[model samples]
Target: MTAPAASPALRRPDGSALRVLVVDDEQMLTDLLSMALRMEGWEVRTADSGFDALTVTRDFDPDALVLDIMMPDLDGMAVLQRLR
Candidate 1:
């Protein structure tokens, strides 16, 4: 199978690091994705629920979000709507 598309590169004009936030209730997948993001030289954080994610989003102010579609409490779409 083909690999998933690469996540958009988050960079600074000064060539500094990027910040990433990963939200997924699946602990294993979140951990794996966090590892990959860290390898890309990003500061990564994760949250296991929508409530927690919103808190993280506020605190982290991530340059990009890696969100899961299915989650307990609230899903990614709902979270995105609230963000918008």
Candidate 2:
């Protein structure tokens, strides 16, 4: 049998592997997504609350972000707004 297809490659402008931040209130979901992204060879970080997300975003400055809209302590929308 042929080898399984590889995941699509991702890169940043500087030619480094892409970085991603996943924000959600659920620890399980965050852990799951972080594991998946890491398997794809992407840098991954996770935050369990919006407030923590904002702080991590500022420090991490990831290439992409996956956010949950409904969360305690400054929802996703507000986080996006503050970032903008």
Candidate 3:
């Protein structure tokens, strides 16, 4: 294989690295995504629950978020509603 194409790098207008928050109940998935995002030079943070996701979002103020559709404590839909 061609070493799996690397993900495209993303950056802000000022050439600063982007910040990303990944939220998922599955630890493995979260860890994997964190690694991939970090490879693109992004600042990555993860939360294992919807509540924790919200808390981290507030504190970190990330530029982007990757959330699972299903999760305990407060599903993704609920979290998205609350955030909006």
TM-scores across all candidates? 0.83, 0.87, 0.85
| lDDT-superior candidate, 1 or 2 | 2
Question: Which segments of model 2 are wrong by more than 4 Å?
Answer: 1-8
Relative to the true structure, candidate 1 reaches a TM of: 0.83
Clashing residue pairs for model 2: none
lDDT of 2 by residue, 1-84 (tens): 999998668788787889899999999999999999998889999999889988999899998999999997988999889889
Sort by TM-score, best first. Answer: 2, 3, 1
Q: Give the C-alpha miss distance for residue 28 in model 3, angstroms.
A: 0.4
- Per-residue lDDT of 72 in model 3: 77
Candidate 3: residue 65 lDDT (0-100): 90
Clashes of 1: 0
For model 1, which pairs clash?
A: none
Full-model lDDT, candidate 3: 0.92
lDDT scores of the candidates, listed in order: 0.89, 0.91, 0.92
lDDT of 1: 0.89
Q: What is the C-alpha RMSD of each candidate to the true structure, in Å?
A: 5.9, 2.4, 3.9
Clash count in backbone of candidate 2: 0
Candidate 1, position 62, lDDT? 84
What's model 3's TM-score? 0.85
